[model samples]
Target: MADEPVLPTLPKTPFNGLGSKRAWAQANAPPPPSVSTSSDPAVFSSDDDPALEAYESARRHKRRYVGTWYDQHLALSSDSVMGDDGSSTIVGSSPVVYRPQRRAKGAVRQQKRQFRKLDSGVYMGGQDSTDTEGDVPSPYTPKYFVSPAQLRVSPRSLPQVSEAESAARDKIKNCVEYGNQEVDLSGLGLNSISAETIAPIADIAPIPLVVKGVSFEQADPDIKVYLYNNHLKDFPLSLVNIEPLTFLTLRNNDLTEIPTCIGKLKNLKTLNLAQNKLKYLPAEIRRLMGDGGKLVMLHTASNPWWTAEKLSFQAVIEQSDPNPLIRTPVEFLDSNGQIYSRFRLPLSDADLAESTSSLELEVEHPSELEMPKEVSYAEGDHVRLLNPTGARSLFEYALKALTKLPEPELEEVDYWLGVDEGYPKGLRETLNLAADAHRSGGLTCSVCGRGMVVPLTRWVEFHKTAGTIRVDRESLVPFLKVGCSWKCVPARQVVPECEEKLPESDD
Candidate 1:
């Protein structure tokens, strides 16, 4: 067997000698020399050639950094790098730590002096130059870090107008005119002068002649004269001839009667006298006339006279031969003397005819009338005759006789029926037609003439126990029966037992 030799390992060092040797060789290597050829023209010559020199000079004049060594390797100048065009590329460089520059001794002293002035409360920077020496001291406390000479304001003074100037400013106080019309009352105590016044002040003007808590004893002649001539419902005339009267209103006055001498005033119009206590009107009030003899419009609603029976003030104005100038309340008087004030009252021909017929019937008949029953009555059936013709005629004669009798001796008709008072005139004709239909053979029973034999066409079987019998299209249920004396015994008399066992043929 043969033995082999091993290679030795190198010791580690801060710089590898192999790497250092390679780097040194690369740094010392010389650049390749340029070639020169005369036949290839001056563009191909080396730097030593004279023609190459001329070409190099021309190239240096025309050459640019476009795709050249400057574009690839040269760093941008600081002036170009800081330009605002934003196209300058920033190259990374090693960052150096920055240190602030030290201030000069004079500048440091000046800063220290300002801080000392501020700290000592000798600051003057914030105060106005024109501020007086006697002005209030600022409330700020100085700080140790600041100079006492540095001035700063704690509370500032605000500009303000003088009290005398503020008081002299003019403002609106009261109204002097309304709707551009002057309020005139020279004859009254009101001043004739015009001035601008507030609206509330203008509205508070006093009214004329307002008396409170006073009663009248036999109304004064002046008051009556003022009332009639001025068309006033109630006017107080303690001393009536007073002047400067333009408007008068006496609403809700408790005036029970009017004076006759009230037609004297010739200068009055537009009086209001609503809600008074007047029942009857004075005849002298009708004489209220103007310069052309036309009556003035009067307003007297809500008075007791409005609902009076005799001499309706409203009706008198409505039925006057010449319509007066007064505004009368329009009321439609019904047949019963009721008044309806609606503009379009519901009135029809049927209602008028019914009212007229009712009046005529009341006059002809003295008692009320009942409606006729649909059930037919047999002859001698002892039925109660409602509003019979004989009874009505007798009542009318008795009523006439009673009218002639003295009040003390006249006897009242105790047996008088109250059913005939409102019967119509043709009721007897209807009764006669009903009687004829009942008498016809179409509804006669062979066993008992009183018991009607209703035809099959007129019979309506309402139930097994109850049926409706019709005669001439009128139907009735027989609730009451009138027994014939020849067929049945009377209630007071009883037949023998043998008599009760009648044959079925006899039923």
Candidate 2:
């Protein structure tokens, strides 16, 4: 009778009509062990009990979640609308409280739909969905930089620096050097590098010098600067500091506007600004279009804002491309027997080879840019020279030279009369060079030591071949009304070649 164990009783709610199956299962469950057994809590009342060790081993040591769920009965206040569409959802603007209520089956659910009306039928959804497809951002608007900022590397997530960068840092310790005049750096365009900190070389070279982005504000007067593909928006004023820059490559950039200060680059010969987002040119930039009678070869074709008239006037040089002027006027060719697309001085094949070979050595290394204390000018150096204009600026000197020349003749010189009416072949060729120089830009007259003036040039025009620029004619231009004052520039005459007949084109 003592070994017959009593069964556990089932709860009243579980044994009710709808839950009787669950209650029956509980009623047939095994009975608890006798109170004195090791499994019973009564025997493990104190730590001294042997059963307490087993209980401690089975207990969980981790912290348990102690938070409560939002109450199912709670609600926010909201307004309702009756319409053809029998469904309702939650709206976010101006929330209102809703009371709990019993509803019949198949009734439209009265859930709130958070929405903002942007247009007639368009609504911006909230809470349950995102509102990313709205028309707030337009295409032309500057796209905000969406990448993470990297001012400095975190100590915990430091990236391994390649051995080459470390070696360049070692070699690039001193930025200032004067031996060969070059600044070459590679793999230094990363976040941690800066021009000032990396080296003291602020003097830019007139040749190719590849380095990381450097501060141009205090840069030296460099030329032939290649800054293409820099993803730039604003043209740096530092570039304005490069006073005598000749060949500047600003291709493939996001340039919107150019400053009038760009007119300062007086000696700039070739300006390559293809593939830019330019809308308009500054009026002062007209100084680049041979306005001051300075020869400026331009390549501004791909600019979106360039009009057809302006593009037609764009100048291309023979040194770069043979056919810079794609289209030719038939009248100009019809007048002369010329069949060439562009005007260029014919060079012997040996001379062409020499020029190409020199270009290869033009790219100077950064280590070679250390300037020498006494910079020596190369031989055969010929720049515009004046008699005695003391401490004059480059532009001022040029102005003085132009004004000092003699006035041209008043009578118009017929181009065809001199060539067809049996004038000396040597004289016709000389006039052609003078016309070329007058059209291109100024080259000082060898005799007068004066620069060419506009409308009526007093300085003699000369051949632009790889030899003598101007022969003779030296005087100061005093404001005078002049026209082709053909005081023929006296110089040694070149041997004339027989003119060839033009080959007819098929109509």
Which prediction has the highest lDDT against the true structure?
2
Clashes of each: 32, 40
Off by over 4 Å in 1: 1-235, 243-246, 290-295, 306-320, 324-507
Error of 1 at 381 (Å): 64
Candidate 1 matches the true fold with a TM-score of 0.18
TM-score leader:
2
Query: Per-residue lDDT of 47-131 in model 2, one digit per residue for the tens?
Result: 2323334544544233222221111100110111211011222222222233332221101123223211211221211111111
Q: Please report, as a residue range, the 10-residue window in candidate 2 with the lowest summed lDDT.
A: 70-79
RMSD of each: 47.2, 27.7
- lDDT value for model 1: 0.25
